[model samples]
Target: MSNKHTTLRKPVLLTSLPLGVMSFLLPIYSKKLGMNAVEITGLFSILSLILIITRPIIGKFTDSFGRKPILIVSCILFAASYFIFSIATTSVLIYAARIFQGIATATMTISTYSIISDTTKENNFSKAFGRIHSYKSTGSLYGCIIASIILSFMTFTQGWKMLFLIFSILSIYSVIEVIKNIPESKKIVTVKCDINKNKSRNTMKLLIIVFMTCISSSILGPVFMIYMQDKFTNNILLLAYAFFPALISESLLSKRIGAFSDKCGYRYSMIFGILICAIISIITPSANSILILAILWILSTLGGVLYNVSEKNIYTDMIGESCVGVMYSIYSIVCDFGLMIGPLVGGILYDNVSHQAPFYLSGFFMVIVAILILILIKKDSICRVD
Candidate 1:
């Protein structure tokens, strides 16, 4: 194992606690702020728009300026965004925070993954992503428990704000970690600002697959808690509990799944994973009790771990280490696009149609992506062997 791979865990672990806290709390907190589902989705869509505009630029700058400085700046901005979130009084202020967070997110995503790509060997890339993801998932699991504990003692908005404050503190620590722990990677040719040198036939196809898969996966984002609210109960602790199984599954299974991809081929692992997840998405809507819901989503979470590890592995390999920031920027754009639009569409469907409609639509899209992946497999373009 690369020394940097072990070192990489520190920053990923530190940064993810805040992100994990936010991910579990955001929708629930936004609802407490009296925002509707469409408003929440719109918030994310706007955030994605900001990222779409900025990530490529951040990537370009990181590629030329070096990853560490950009990464440090991102951490600073991320901490500031959480400060903004903690004191946000209006939905408009939340919008401002999201914009800053979006920019921070773009820089962080491209720089961090690019660094991982630079430091880790190509052969170990799958395991690297999986391990990093496991760390984040584990952090998120603990974050949910932390949020639940806070909520137990305080009001919903107050608990959420406290979580934001916790995030702000952790992000500041993340900045220190970046400067002290992470060594700078290769200083690439600085003047090639075109940002278009990395695109290939395979990359476009991969991006399309990624976009579809992200849309399907994120389609429930705006309305999942609402669905849970409608079905089981509206308790925040219960919702926090609901996130537990998925996070645990991701933490435990990601490394093993990555190994599976290494041996079985990325294509096989991804296809099987997606099919399981897609089929489970269909069944999840029918879950009438917490036991059934947990079981179904836990399975979906396992599938998620499988597909996600393989996807990042293949995507990183195809893009190459040198072009990490630029290509991942493009990758982030498509992913953010999917994540943004899915929620908007899902929120609309959830409000207008039945609550179950979003899940159905989401499952349908996953099936489409699964079919798309199948076709690519037939063409021998999507699946690659190391």
Candidate 2:
């Protein structure tokens, strides 16, 4: 990587790390605060809904103004939101904190992604995106390990508050890193209203494909750990262990998949990913053996990495420089929608039906997404050419 790439990487890594920390700490903390499953789900659902509504406006602002101002403001909001979360005594307060957090999260993520996509070329997207994912995974690993240690030595509530403080400090550091190290992309020209000016049929197709891909990928994200805990005796250690493979595999193998996607085209790469994920989902329910479950978990991670790398690169390629932020925001919205729905649906199915039903449903959805992507590729080939 060049010096410029290195510069961009630092801030991206720093920003990702704190968010990763929050991801692990928040749920555990929520439980400690006496939140029921329904409350927890409702909190996230409201957050997702807020993000879905706000992303496009944030994306538009990033395009019209610049990435730096939006990013800095968002980071500050992110930091302050944690303070509110730390002090929350009621469910309504929790909901309010999450709403602010959601807005900040959406703004920071969309702006940063827009900056990275603008800085990197189409051909280099996979490698860059892979590195980003790796940084994110490393952050998650560190946060989870540190939080676990803290919880072991202290009360859960105390550990949770400490984690929130840590995240707030990290957010401040991320802001500094962005200011000192990451340079603004020289290629991004200020656009007034071009975000909505031109829309190609291919762009619409790409957006639909990206939406489907996100929905399929997020099917198990929120509910999987819960399922594991319920079935395996609610062992936190075991739950953490089950997650290790997915995180580790994605951090290690995503770059290779990204590089492959750059060379082989996003369509083929995503197809392979979706197929593998579908297979894993279909087999996951029948795994009476822990060993098989672990293997499937790793495979699912591999598939997710492939899908992420390819789909992101494709979105950048399709939208190009003009509307990258808006495109990414749209992607985020669809993804969060899926994430919100997945847990609710999974919980209902697990309660009313078999625990295995969620996996089958998830697998079936992936299959549908895979077929949609294939159809998109055919349509694009018939109408557009280089």
Candidate 3:
């Protein structure tokens, strides 16, 4: 492993922990606060919209002021958001917390991604990202286990509040780690001419691919949890169990899968990943029991990990070395645009149309995205990092 990658692992893991803890429970917590499907998913839409607006600004800052400072700001914002979430009772307060998280996400994702792309070699992209995501998934797994243990002893309200408080403290610690341990990325100047010449058209293609894929994933975002709540046990621990094995497996497999992508080529791995997710999404609504659903969820998550590792590799290939921060933020904007649309439509469809509408739509769209990837992305289309 590279020295820079080694330096980044702990902070990356620290950053992902809070997100993992929040992923399964946030919808339930929002529901407890009187949010319906629309409202619960609307919070995500609001966050994505904020990301679209702020990411470019954060990107510019990342390029100019350096990555470490932006990351520190992002960690502080994450801490603040969790603190607000711990105390929130109203939807307004929830929205406020999500807004803070949105900005944090904008800063955190762009800077971290840029730093990785800047430091890692192009051919090693998948392996490096895989190893990093392994740490991230491990952190998330720990968060899920910890949150489940806390919930096992307390009422839902109390458990969620305590979880957010714990998340806040973790984020604060992450901030200190960033300040003291993480090193700044060295600027890349050698490849500017090549990057400037070829980046535009390929960048557009990548953005479209990302936007559609985001829609595919987010189409069932809040609605899936709502369905689980209605049909299965409302116990958060059970939900955590459904994810626990999957998280462990994904964490363990990330590096191996990344290495596989590096050797076997990105196209087939990405296509297969997308198809697996599509198949699982299509089959999920038909699950008759929690066990069956957990099995399917595990498959879906593994598929997602496959797609994500390859996708990040492709995305890093597209990034201009000289402006990794700004380019990545632009990429994130496209992702958030799709994310903003998918959840709103999914929630509306679930409420007014049918519960299965979002699932089927999500599956169908993923298949289309997979086909698009097969056609649009090619070996020569991807630029190498210098």
Q: Which candidate ranks first by lDDT, i.e. highest? A: 3
| lDDT at 285, model 2 | 71
Which lDDT values do the candidates have, in the order given? Answer: 0.78, 0.72, 0.82
lDDT of 3 by residue, 1-386 (tens): 37777777766776677678776678778998888988886776677789999998998899878899998998899889989999999999999999999998889888888788877877788888888888888988877777768888999899888988888888899888888878888484765434355457766887798899998899887688778888787786677677677889888898888877777677777888999999998988889998898788778988888788888898788664767777777788888888878887888989999999899999999999999898888853243333
Better of 1 and 3 by lDDT: 3
lDDT of 1 by residue, 1-386 (tens): 55776665655665566565665567666777788877776776777799989988988787778888888898888888888999987788888899988888788788878887787776666677777778778767666767768878998878778888887888898889888977888456555544455676777887899988988898898788778887789785666566677778888877777766666777667888898888888888777788788788788988887888778877887776556678888888889888877777888999999888888888888888877777774322333445
The CA lDDT at 141 in model 3 is: 83
TM-score of each: 0.89, 0.89, 0.89
lDDT of 2 at 362: 82
Ten contiguous residues with the weakest lDDT in model 1: 377-386
Error of 2 at 126 (Å): 1.8
Position 68, candidate 1: lDDT: 86
Going through the candidates in order, what is the number of backbone clashes in each?
Answer: 0, 0, 0
Better of 2 and 3 by lDDT: 3
Instruction: Judge candidate 2 at residue 327 and give its lDDT.
Output: 72
Give the Cα error of residue 374 in candidate 2, in Å.
1.7
Q: What is the lDDT of residue 344 in candidate 3?
A: 76
Span of 10 residues, lowest total lDDT, candidate 2: 377-386
> What TM-score would you give candidate 1 relative to the actual structure?
0.89
> What's the lDDT for candidate 3?
0.82
Q: Residue 34 in candidate 2 has what lDDT?
A: 90
